[model samples]
Target: MEGSRRRTTAPRARPAATRPTREAGGTAAALPDAGSHGPPRGARSRRGELDGAPAETPRARAAPRRAPARPRDTQPPATDGARAAERPAVPEPQPPADPEAPAVARRPSSRRGGRSTARQPRAPRRSRRERDQLMDVLHALRLRRQETCVSANTVNTVVTRLLRGLGNRESEFEGVEQLNTGSYYEHVKISAPNEFDVMFKLEVPRIQLQEYYDSGAFYLVKFKRIPRGNPFGHFLEGEILSATKMLSKFRKIIKEEVKEIKDIDVTVEEEKPGSPAVTLLIRNPEEISVDIILALESKGSWPESTREGLPIQSWLGTKVRTNLRRDPFYLVPKNAKHGKGFQGQTWRLSFSHTEKYILNNHGTEKKCCESGGVKCCRKACLKLMKYLLERLKQEFQELDAFCSYHVKTAMLHMWTQNPQDSQWEFTNLSFCFDKFLMFFIECLRTEKLDHYFIPKFNLFSRELIDKKSKEFLLKKIEYERNNRFPIFDKF
Candidate 1:
């Protein structure tokens, strides 16, 4: 082994790049030094040397050249090597052991008092005060809105008496049961509870649905097997249920019952074209309106258009969605905008029940928004949006086509986009409300807000809202947004 060993002299000093650095933690860490790029300081350049020929040092080579003198107080401009030498070497950050863990922020260099020198951004001036004032205004508006809502006891008492009279007088309407629906029952009602949507649902046997319009919203209802002694036999026109005739008969029965209740001053309002509700104007103690919608409850499967919609797997859960879909859907006596041919035969599909359930139990977690659980500003955001729409409608009568339902649909879609409970934290009310408004404004700009249940159906289509009106509404909304919603001040 000694004979095979090659001659060896004093070992050359290990390069500074391989030297250990004493870190602030009192640990010697091996790090590549700044001078690793070239020969060590005071060493001659080996770039052109051959066979041990004499080489020139950097300072010796530059000694012949002279540069302009700067001010005495000004130091010489730093070279790349000098700058690198001054900067402490930092290792490339190692990723977290858990890939899903959030990344750690890199430490600021020690040169700038351990602070970032790239202009630390100052927080928005008066932002907290503005947000606080906005929330206070919203809370006041909500209280005022609550005051406008008609008393629940008063509504129940009047509806109970009216329905009882209808059941006793009309045998055909005996099976009709009340299904509370709409924004009022959903607990998002603003302005007044004087307006109520009560669906008079009549259970129907197995039925087939055919799309009446391309929108898949209006449908033609047909019974597979007409039951014997079906009171609706007269309301049928060539095997298809006549929504017009049935609704007219329903209106007549309700009108007769209203006359019987002389104690309460109630009068059926004149029927509006294309409206399915038989509106009742009550003027005994307060001026209140009740919209009695005639609906057909069907236990059959939902239409094919809804197959790709209701994306609630990541939000409300797939099992919850499936269970909700199993519940009966209603067919209101609502016809298309241009229902010239089949004016009285069309029925619009109503998912008011699903909407109510989703709103009432809206949360990713079971205890979310409940007592002792994390509260969210979802409902508050919705109310503010609704109130915004209401105020805008008052200013611009052209926005009559835009209703509270449009706002509700936008919010549901917003939930799917932002599913985290933390995003809707109640403490961040102003932030969440602004986010929701921006989403709604985007929908208005695109002129394409999809129906919650039917993806193919565009609620903001030209048929429902003209392009000119939408453009005008967009400007108004943007103006309100930029001005911190001055319209909300009216409330």
Candidate 2:
């Protein structure tokens, strides 16, 4: 036991050949012996262990010999070839999943960082021949609708005769000239163009106009100088003119005038509340409905709310914009009866004359879309939008509040944003239409379709249209876009 203790306690002497040597700096350096120890300290073997280590306990032997990770700076520099060889192979992308496979199996793993592959199958694209056939059908439909459009000659003749009859019948309407307005006058009439709007404007000079509400489109008119023999004097309440009384008298006069026309069977429709027009139905060769509006044309400055409105300077140039601003504004005898207690009679302001002028002469270039100039799809786009709205209205009665006016407003805003005539080139019709639709969707999503003339007026009001109806329309439009307009197939 004493001898075994001495053998274990004594420091094992190294042979002379394997002894440590003292360097010139007096530092002793130990030379590694190949046979004495299996390997150097911390040097890993093929099995990833320190060679020649003492037999570990079961616990120590079971545990992994975790190598102290070297700092990145201390790591050996690797060659490109080495890195390439060390890298794990990336698998080739799999082909599109089998159509017959379960949807869950067909979907690519989200862990792979790819877009969702579980989208609804896209409709097969139509062939060129098929597309042409469809276009031919559309053209035929367009022609059929065009046939129903009221002839320009007929419209002018009727308007002239009616104005003459009105002047002769009523002294108040003696000098009131007719200003043709609406989509028919704008040349963007879609579907049946049997509807016509002619404003019988009586220039009310030296009139004090006050806005009835926050909306710039409504106003209350008062006479600054009351004429002694004026027939309108009786319609005035205190200092302000009563739009309701004036409209009532105007409608009575129009009814009497319609009875005088014998050659053409003209019948006056019953008056509608809040409607500004005295509707006349002409049944001659074809049915034509004309709305004769009574308006007090004022040359006064536009309302304060309109200061920031009509941002068309960049699109129509400053000179054109300035001229439009200088044009006379009109207030028609139209009032919205909110409730029984609503007192102040409101007159809706009209910019129809200006709107018609802008539509006819809408080119950034002087001769744009004219006889010799480049043709843009602006008018065609407007017609398509109007047709679409008409069709949509037939399908969804809830969308009745959304009309062509909203589409026109959106188009106006879109034009201002993308001012260049080249942007609306006929060749880029599909792309332009898609962009317009996208903009419309954005407006619907935000629930704020602003009136073009009045930015303050939100056309998409909860009072006017249901919020869910707007969302439903949005989804429908998106589906149409995604599926390449299957709705047009039915059309």
Candidate 3:
């Protein structure tokens, strides 16, 4: 009996090699001998122990309940090396739901350990594409600029002949000399060289200027002592020279002279209200508009209003400023739209001569943007701004009040603010253009763009651009900025 009992209680031999196998729930379970068709060792032992034990209590007899094992894909990733090998292969990591999600999701890989968190790929910056497009447009504009040289020559000939004819035919216009002005003379005219401005500068001696009301831009010009048989005496009302009368006679004379140019298809456009120019429409195949301005050349000191203006001392140097101030300023026969009897006689002050000199000699260094010097992108920035305004105005007639002069004024101010030539690098066109746009946007937002020469006179006052139009224009510009300026695509 003792021998039989020993055989029954004896310990069994262990398998040569035992390997762990992952069950359905990824719970490690011991594997049986390869050839054996039996339950695992743990299960057999638990069954034999249960059979020998006394009848258990309800708590002990009842097995603990377990929730079903989750699928391998549903489980959290295993960090343990051994468990990771036993677990089913995991699929490649997936991107977050939102593709346009912020950059937080795309953190760069960690460097401390070889571990890296999943990151979504990011979108490229728009500037690269924007730069490419801008370069292409500028190239096209350059090609078109070459085409305008022919028209410019033809227009110059017609203007020279017209000036000669006017001096010969009219006694009043005998001493008038052409002072070429506007974007054309500055060499910044874009799209087409269809517009031109020529000032008929008449010498006025012993003149006095009184500021017209609070507006420093307009002036009441009078002769200190009336000259006997002065050509301008016929147009004078009292001591004040009547801008309205002078402009009227100037237009009439221009009309009569335009009639004599039978070789060129030229006709005088009727005088526009509050405009100083006697515009001539010349159609030499393509339509060309020429503005003939009558200016009274003044050899006196500049107006008191311009004392603190120009701000070019730092940019053009103190000597340059002194020289520029020494030069004579001119007054044009430009009447205010809202001017009454006294105001109607007032002439607006002009700095076209000064503007031309500044533009021609524009540079921090003497030879900036010159043939042998560092070529800056100041003119390119100005041209782009002008083109932007032109394109915007064409699409919306509401922006007609906005003009190239505003752009020029803004650019001149920018030069003063960013005096360094490095700020306007030609190769950095996109960056420079964006800076200009942002500055312009800020001016529009504040509604406080001051006239370059007359700081007291706000060009963007409520009288000039109403609140609603300014807001609408602001939105359009912002939209263009955010969307990579689709309007420039037209170029």
TM-score of each: 0.72, 0.70, 0.73
lDDT of 2 by residue, 182-224 (tens): 9887978755557788899998768887876566667778888
lDDT of 3 by residue, 167-283 (tens): 887567778898999998887877777888989898988899888777889888889988688888988888888999988887887787778777888888876778889898888
Give residue 141's lDDT in candidate 2 (0 to 100): 43
How does model 1 fare in lDDT?
Answer: 0.66
TM-score of 1: 0.72
Candidate with the larger lDDT of 2 and 3: 3
What candidate 2 gets wrong by more than 4 Å, as runs, is 1-150, 340-344
C-alpha-based local distance difference test score of model 3 = 0.66
Clashes of 3: 0
RMSD of 3: 26.4
lDDT of 1 by residue, 1-491 (tens): 11111111212233334322211111111111111222212212223331123333333222222432322112123343344454445432211122211111122233221111224322122145546766776666553544454455566666787678877764667878889998778878766666788888889878999897576898888988887987778989998998898889989988877777766677899999889999988774777788989889998788887776776766788898899888888899998777344467889989998999999888887888889998778898898888888889998998988988899988887776555565566655654565565556557756778888887788988877898888777778756765667786677
